[model samples]
Target: MIERDPLAPSRWSAEYRTGEFDEPFPWKPVLGVLGIVLVIVFAHLELQSKRIDELHTAINARLGGELEPLRGRFTARLSTLRAWLELREIDGPKMRAADLDFETIRSGGLLSVRRKRSAPGGGSSIELDSDEFGECLGVPSTSIARIQRRLAEFTPELRDEIDRTDHFLTLRGMQDQLDRRIDALLPELSLAIEARFLLLSEEDAEARELMLLLVDLESGQEKLRMRVPYEGRLLTARVMLDETTRAKSPGSIALPTELPKGASDCAAASTLREAIDGRHSIGEPMPEGGEHAAE
Candidate 1:
């Protein structure tokens, strides 16, 4: 390093210096300015973040207020729809049952009038097996008592279904109780055999059912009590069966020497060559024509 005199006189306006910093750089002023700039930038960023959060909160609040009523209405509508579906579910089986009952009622008259055999009074009726019920003619109370005794073996609920007038049932006592298949009563409610037994009644609805016969569709098994007679011309057979179906079906009577052609249920048709001179119980066999009763 060169030393210069402190009192020397300056002669030029421009001075050229070949010397630079001989000690460490001065850093305090630069650091102070940089710190001020950093503080300003950080404060600006913090303010922007706070404003952005407040804007988001305001937007969310406005949207929630607008949608609250819509949400409530939607919830109520959904609840109403669910309730309606539930009600329909509850009524579906009932409606189906009612429809089936209506159909049964509509065809009930035709069903009752379906006569495979003719009655003495020319009304609708069925003819029973002769050997089983030939003695039921001219005496009804005995047969009725016997049938009632058999019916006693059944539950009162099932006995209540035997209401149709002239509805017939041939009880075999071989099938299980009627209540056992009672659940299938509706689905299998059909009549195919009316020539065996007769269930007599006076009224339709308020009438008491004294007899019932049910035949299973799948098993061909019978489910009722008692047997009956099926035979004879309207003229002779009806005389023997007086007051059974309807009061007296005979007119200008003849004892019926020979049953009408193709007619076989005539009580007088016995090969014994005589009219009804003796009374025989349905359980007894006649001395004529090998006429035996069925169990």
Candidate 2:
């Protein structure tokens, strides 16, 4: 290259600069980033799918094999509790009609675990059956659940009954701690309970064994809840339904059905108000299978 000053045309007060040249874009880095983003998105979706499947499996297991049956057992126990208190019917399918009797009106599910309390101070523990563990965990688990607590919140009568039952148990069980005047009433209550047994009708006895059963833990739940009517207030409930001669009446609700198979979830007693909602102007259609309970 030679430096030479040759024939220059001069322009006044203008600076010289070069223009920008066009070049191919940097596609590789951009494509790598896009591919990484797609991979991340796909990975997130796969993780979500796996979580959903696990949830479904857990729910099914809870419903079918382990949890639900224990819940049903515990519900049946409430009926047992009711009988112990000398309240009304136990509609375990077998108790259906034939008596839609006065007991039927007081009808519902009850469960009992009958093993003499070893006289309060005796260190005797009842040997639990394999299913007993299921019952223990299931009741309290569902007891505080949203559906059940809502049921309690909705029914003041139920809350009252629970309080009443607890009160009765407290008074009766702790007679020594009671005031003198209230203690005197216990004898009269016993007499009243005895009279109820004598007054119980034959037909009423046939359905859910209108009396409470007194037995040991070895007797098993099947024996405790057996539909054998008794003379005094006894724990007798139909564990299995004799569906053959079952008479159909909406008023005569079945144990397993009306309860949506969950009694702690429903009610022992329903008044005229509960049976029908009068607030609604028009009648609504009935659902299939009838009285389907909350899941």
Candidate 3:
């Protein structure tokens, strides 16, 4: 109510008391700042998403470019190897069975008999025959004598035993003893043969399983190769891929690149010589260009 001095500080005016100095909370400036912040955040997120997409594309391209060719080469070589293994499997069983049969006979399945023979000079020599050695001794005496000579070379101990025995009855007893000895040896012989058969069977099975796995891998690679864009350098890449797949062996396929770790387990590096010649000396190598030989 008192008059105010001009130089003195003035008391609050009616406008100030009514909030006229507040400036409506500056909502436009605040909204503008918020918009700028949102734009910056969205821009950063967009950049991150774009980078992620680029990385994904790069990874996929690398996989298609590199892994697919390797897979193709591996498959081709594996197919060749599997073919060879199949051939071995086909011819192996009959030969092994025949050998086992011979082993059974050699282990003592034949009888041994000796008879006195009169030579052309009127001096007598010893002759031999048995159920296993010669045919029934009477019908064709010449055939019997030839068989006896062959048996002499094969079973000298049996011949000696027969010759030492005085009487035919004693020789018969010795034959029975040989039969019993054979029966006693059969179980062990059969066990050995079975063990060998199982070993070979297991080896063949492992090779087959590895071949199947390679087939699956090859199928997957083929699909991936199809997906790869055929444009640009990829066309040349495909040509090179074809060349790689045409390789006959792992050494040729992995050339200029180290073999994958599991390659040895697949037997991919095994030589053609090893497959053809084999480790065993059981039979002669199949002649080259033979119909049965794998190409």
Best by TM-score: 3
Q: What is the TM-score of each candidate against the true structure?
A: 0.21, 0.26, 0.28
Q: Residue by residue across 146-240, what tens digits does model 1's lDDT show?
A: 32233245444433332211211222121233424332231212221112222221111122111222111122222122122323325443343
Candidate 3 lDDT, tens digit per residue, 1-295?
2333556775665553444333457779999999999999999888766655554444334334543344345345435434322322221211111112223222322221222233432232423222211122111111222332432332556545554554444544655665454444333333222221111011122222211110011111100000101111111112233466775433333223443323322232132112222432334432322222233
Query: Which regions of candidate 1 are displaced past 4 Å?
Result: 1-29, 87-295
Residue pairs whose backbone atoms clash in candidate 1:
128-229, 128-230, 129-229, 171-224, 171-225, 171-226, 231-265, 232-265, 232-266
Clashes of each: 9, 17, 0
Winner of 1 and 3 under lDDT: 3
Better of 1 and 2 by lDDT: 2
Model 3, stretches more than 4 Å misplaced? 1-18, 21-24, 88-201, 204-292
Candidates' C-alpha lDDT: 0.29, 0.30, 0.31
Question: Which 10 successive residues of model 3 have the least lDDT summed?
Answer: 221-230
Rank order (by TM-score, best first): 3, 2, 1
- Model 1 lDDT, residue 62, Cα: 32
Error of 1 at 234 (Å): 68
* Candidate 1 residue 53 C-alpha distance from true site, Å: 1.9
Q: Please give the lDDT score at residue 189 for candidate 1.
A: 22
